[model samples]
Target: MSKTLTFRHVSYLWDEAKALELAGNEVDLFIYRSNLLGADLRLTNYAGGNTSVKIMETDPLTGQPVPVMWVKGSGGDIGTLTKAGCANLYVDRLHALKSRYRGLEFEDEMVELFNHCLFDPKCATPSIDTPLHGLLPYKHIDHLHPDALIAIAASKDGEAIMKEIWGNQMAWIPWQRPGFDLGLKLEQAVQENPNLRGIILGGHGLFTWGETSYESYINTLEVIEQASEYLEQRYGKKSPVFGGARLENTDEQTRKNRAADLMPTLRGLASSYRRMIGHYTDDARVLEYINSNDLDRLAPKGTSCPDHFLRTKIRPLVLDEPEKLAQKSADELKAYLTGKFEAYRADYAAYYERCKHDNSPAMRDPNPVVILWPTVGMFTFAKDKQTARVAAEFYTNAINVMKGAEAVSEYVGLPEQEAFDIEYWLLEEAKLQRMPKPKSLSGKIAYVTGGTGGIGKAICEALLQEGACIVAVDRNLLDETQTDLRKRYGKDNALSAAIDVTDVATINDSLRQATLQFGGVDIIVNCAGLSISKPLAETTQKDWDILQDVLVKGQFLVSQEAVVILRKQGLGGDIVNIASKNGLVAGPNNVAYGTAKAAQLHMSRLLAAELGPEKIRVNTVNPDAVLRGSKIWEGEWAAGRAKAYGISIEELPAHYAKRTLLNEEILAEDIAKAVRVFVDGSLSKSTGNVLNVDGGVAMAFVR
Candidate 1:
């Protein structure tokens, strides 16, 4: 349950500045929210959470201090507080604090942090968490509450639970108050094992740290989610809504046009989750819920969680058109905003009051989360796509929780002051700062069947140029080929394996080895295929099976293995099936090859639809016949084709080239590019597309 809820990308961010801000704020928020979520949900909240940043303050040569740690501040709520909720305390002070005690005794180290402040006035008090954050040597530190911790905390045999869940792999501590003792205990645990990833705070939360903020954040989320999944499987009831979310982008003209502009912005926002982005406006279920009169009489269920308030606002903008419901909803939203923010109506007055405390600009956009137009239900707004998604997810979860919570207590929220504090926190803003850009496929790994073949080699080169690491699998070890590739790039960038794609064991072994070697595979391009030039009468079952084994079965086997890894990674993937133009058009003599190729195309479509929900993209590329390296030259199949058509092979190239509307011979490179397109952003809305890279062959049959 926790695993499903936790977004795998909670840690990594594309924007370095934002990544820094996100890491810091996330760690702080996880720590703050853990208590509210309890050990179970807090563990779900973050497997581990830590924060740190590299900022210049003064030159070291000039004997000046540098800004070291932006640690979590005390008395901040995870559900609300933003970046400013964290404190920027000196690293040296934290280092000293860790040295002073076996465990973190944060209160005892207050004087050290206060004295080490690089810029603050001497009178200002340091954040209560400064010593805690400082105790670790990591650039980022996070304390998470994994679900297993919570379950153990809730259980009568917590010690048994601890041993069962962690065994000897993790350190455990009894629950304690947030600030001093917990920090000290954690510091002591860290000292005991310098290589420790983190310590489980018994009934409290989990602690994790990383060399970088992103790593810390990701580690935290992963640990928590895993524990949550384990606990939920053991003890949790299935949610009333248990199926996977089928979020399709709406076909509204506004949405379609907006998506065009929105995709790039979102891609730039977060490199991880923003990959091949798609979003739904209002899901069918949500629409139904809004239209149902059943909810109209019932009070509006407030937000699911506090973070959602920034996106969806307190409640969904309800729309049930008996008469003029859309207009009524819009008006209601306006009224609600007017009623909610007292100062929104008198912005000028509020502006004047703020000017007295040293002038800064007023809020940029005063409009809150939800907007409902007449006849139109609701629209949630955020600065970017992630926020919008977060809003929608929260709103959905909140609605369910509200249904049950209302039966017991009114849906009260945190104090407005706390909410406001989170809303405008500068540290939170900083946490959103961007990072030095990573290469296009720095973290991406790919598997290429027939990787030693010419076309396969070209595709591998193309993917490699884009920064992807390749796993090249052929029937025999291509060490020389791999050595050349490695020499061109680096040793860690490519792997070569020997495996028969026809055999299930061989295919599985190849996939397992590739995954174990590279951590995981992302793109699987099935270039390992076979062709037989036998007449229909001469085509034997053995021939058909051979073709299928290398083409159809081979592709399926590779795709299956890749899917499992992709699902585990919680990231979508790309699969490309290289089918020949013979598959699309009629083939006279090559019965088995054509049939297998045609089957491969259909298989691609089926897989695309089946894997769409997993975010795994699938597509096929149909290429015209071509010699291995040809300049208007024909292959044996081209000659066979010419003979079948009563034409000379010499005229075949011109005849076939002219047959296509493009009036050109299709090159292997052209087909490879199309394969790249299936995995690239060439067609944003394309999937299950049998892209014809054939030079106008079968012009009437365009797909």
Candidate 2:
């Protein structure tokens, strides 16, 4: 095929040296090619495409050469594909199953039989698109979901456009739910046109094949590049994309502030059925679509590709004009959004009822996965941050598809019945059912003050392991700690902010950052504190003021700002104050520090009572002599306390431990475990209570 139009094209990334390095090994070359294609989002989305290579291997039982097909496994991303991540199957066995194919209605039954054809019984589970690769009569095959190709495939005149672009070099197939029957059709099409190098699945994706992996890789890129160039030429000629912008965007900061303010209420509404973590994006393309006149007309039609809508749901909930929405008070805006949510739920239920078959799974949560707010951005919610973020990305891909289609021809969405079939497909339902149960704090977002310090870092990690997204707040931002948390968990699951919690403005700003990063906060850990040990006669006014400022005032300010977001969510949250054992036990020369801890303890009880009606629980965890990892102990507090005890600084931990009933040294992790128990749904009903994690300090026990 030849192209007349000139535009920027996707770079051909196949390295001759790399290919030559794995010349004799087809599987390795296949993996290399798959990774290269998947490296570009324009070629495929994360885990959205599959690739396969057929190679001859010695049969383990027969000692004879047999053809085996290695394809991307189910739930595996092509970019990250590994040898273990590929499902290996017997090609002859796969082809033999065609005799058992009953028809289109029974094509799903073929998936179960694929297990019988596995070349390795221990191999990864094959994807639903396995037959799309296995049935094709080629050594290498690629099935990708590229926005440019999907644009043509989803256009009203998709077939005609294909004819104009490639004539008979590429074949066009109408929309069909992927299964054994679709694979049979692909085989038939290729057999009839021996010269065909690719096929476009209307309203879906693209398929291309070659005798070698490099040939297939080049063919896939060539097809997408030509389509993109053609679309660009047509796009440039169009006077305005998406019927031109209908609303002017406010300043970027104003949009972000408004988005932050709106997120908690939106998240609460989305979580009405089940809790959902959220992700927000104001990408240029997202803003362009949200501000366009075509948004109302295009957004409700939903997405065309199966991969796009599967993550983004069929249609998004688009809010009213930004100018008008900005005028409403917080309460008024929330009430209005509540009504919108109810209507959306009803509509989704009705759609399920209208299209469900006898074996259809129960209707899922009816909340919109994607929410569009003009002048602000897009908000996507799911059971976790990564899913929510991916949903937003898929919607952005859908927007690109729509823009391209509209530039050349009218954009078309999947037919309602077709969309419903894919959404509620039995196989899809089984996949959903097979997912592992959520962790303790799966969808919760937490704000941990002093998160870079010993106790604070432990709290962050513990919460993260339980699946909560963490916003690590501290007066001193520690890049190493934040990087480690992010790397250990996912980047989205951990964020760090520098703020003086004693300053209300900084406290508000930190909470706002938390809101924007992870929708909103459901748990607050007031672990930020300081200590000043001194006899009353020797203590200075500055020492007293600083202790109170950080230990008492800081907790109050952080809690106060965080409560604003919690109340907006209406999801009843947890507030765990890390008080000191000195608050309950009398200690010589520890007046200022002990007094501040006592104040923090009482504040938790008072807030617990005040916020009880809102379902926000407040509690305290007190730890004594956490000298091993404590920042407080790194200062004069340890030396002062040791001197008061008439012991060397090195002997402080042992001395404190010997005083406890259990005679155990308290660690920061021990304190973290106490905090976890309070918020991990184990003690949901207990609040305004204190837990002593001081290795059994009898005098420090809560009465």
Candidate 3:
């Protein structure tokens, strides 16, 4: 654990910038330097820090050089600092407005006022720490809650520790929830010590400033390095240890396979709480932390720093005595996880009740973001996978911080009252709740068969945009297609599986896996299908068998498994089968394809009736002439269709578009739209019905 702090930047563009005299002074340098500063999870996980540079810009209206500080925008991560991520604000106005609300602490009103003080109204909302940057006299100001600094900053003896570490170099500003009052407090602290290099907010984070971005960044790192050295010298490896650094002693691959085996149950268990859950267990850091013998004691001892309260809860939920879990049945294991989560939640509620009388915000959800199961490793939950990954990163960093602190002294967590003040502070809570309203299917899980292909990706993407996580099920989709999806939705939100859609065992395992990882399935999209377009006389036995297995048997097996999970969850879900137009109407050379789809369409109506009592709705989406991105039309299939129409392959789309009643070309996206409508339960009461997405093809109507 004797690691060095890395200050590597892949590229700084210093040479080109130097030619223009804006090398280190320009706003873009803040973006570049901020990205580097934010990239280190050890320093700032995800969007945990902010960076800025004070520059004078001529106002378009006033035609005068006004003082402006470019601050990290709210919801913008320093790790991905584009120009748009920085908000320019008039520093004078921000400081001047502070005196008007000197006595009043209005959370929402202060945020509103910050928005109005924007130098450019077109810029994003300014950071809540805007005044901290604006009021400081330094030309460059950067703030981050580095765990090492926070370990001492958040300690019971923090002031003494800091006073000893830096003497009079850094000022100590006692615990203030980040807001207008805190900003003014920082202003007062600076006024008292004009020569101070930086200020450590009590139980909060670090603020370092210098004349240039490089100067500020260097100072930030050096201060942190100094603290790390002191902590290490005082109580690192030399100290007597509690169950020193023991691991599961299994190979990495074996650990991951085992974690995967029980992940669905984990997801299902966490989902039973207040929010949808996503996870990251592939991390070696998380694995090392969880596998350690001291996890149960250290993991639940509250966050090493206050900011982690926003991502991880006050502490993690640890399932002790995991050996017993191995003996339990799948249902038993699920129940065990559920029980542990419930107990954690109940305790959280009690904690909130105990603290809210001291002016905390309304009790947020009691769900713990970090779940530590000894056998299965660590899983971090969020509303979606992207945020879950960030939580995972933060929790992983917490592992290092807490252990590092433990090695120094028994890692003293912030008192419950102080943790509460930081957790429910209106400024932080407002940012958390300021997100856009949830969609109808928001935080719901949807499993889409054939998720890698055109229609499947489209369907999953649409659901994702509306706030749903999709487990795209396909054999090949598990590779590149899944990677692309993870890139779009998030590695946590988009999952992929290679499975036989027709095999009951394979189908069941896929559903269970999704269940454990996403709290059981809420919407199932049956989009996996194939068809042979050979003439009846030319078609062989293999073609018929292939069509029947995927189009009919595959639908039955996957749907059957999904229903079992939904029934157990008691959530009343939706199932939308992607049946073809050929199911309703016969076309030439479509004997195998049509008959199999006919069975699928009939099976939907039958399943709908049987599952109606449980409130699980079943419906069919029949799309026609979807020439673009249809997996069914690959290889000889497209040529065969063109031959059937007596036209060149290139002319087929035009020919098919004209075949529709509306004379418009149908696409996979159109089919995905129909599936979404059904999944959203827009036609909630209507099931066992067929909705066509073929640009108004009259022939495909359910006559």
lDDT (Cα) of model 1: 0.54
> Each candidate's lDDT (Cα)?
0.54, 0.91, 0.76
Best by lDDT: 2
Candidate 3 has its poorest 10 consecutive residues by lDDT at 7-16
TM-score of 3: 0.86
TM-score of each: 0.40, 0.98, 0.86
lDDT of 2 by residue, 1-703 (tens): 3422332667577789989999999999999999998898888888898999999999999999999999999899998898999999999999999999999878788999999999999999998899988999889999999999999999999999999999999899999999988888899999999899899999999999888888888788888888998998897476589999998888889988988998999999999988899999999999999999999999989999999989988799999977788698877888899999999999999999999999888898999999999989999999999999889889999999999999989899988899999999989888888899999999999899999999999999999999999999997756888899989998879999988987988888888888888899999999998888899999999999998999898888888889989988999999999998988988899888899999999999999999999999999999888988889899688889888989999998889889989999999999999999999999999999999998887788677
- Which is the winner by lDDT between candidate 1 and candidate 2? 2
Error of 3 at 102 (Å): 4.1
After superposition on all C-alphas, the RMSD of every candidate to the true structure, in Å, is 17.2, 1.7, 4.2
Off by over 4 Å in 1: 1-436, 629-656
lDDT of 1 by residue, 1-703 (tens): 0122345423322345544454545444333333333233333332123334434455445678565665444434334334555556556655655455544323444444445653433322344445556665566565533434444443334455556655655677764444555556677877887766666653334666656544555566666555544454542133322122223323455433332222222222222322321123445535433543334433243332334444454333332232432244544633443353334324423533443223223343443344322222334444333344445554543443333222222233333333443444443333333334545555566789888776777777777776677888887548976998889976657778887876777776666655444445678888886566667887789988888888888888878866766664456778888887878777678888888888998899899899888778888887775555532133455555676778887776677788788788876678667766666556646678887877676642655
Give the distance in Å from residue 425's predicted Cα in candidate 3 to where it truly belongs. Answer: 3.4
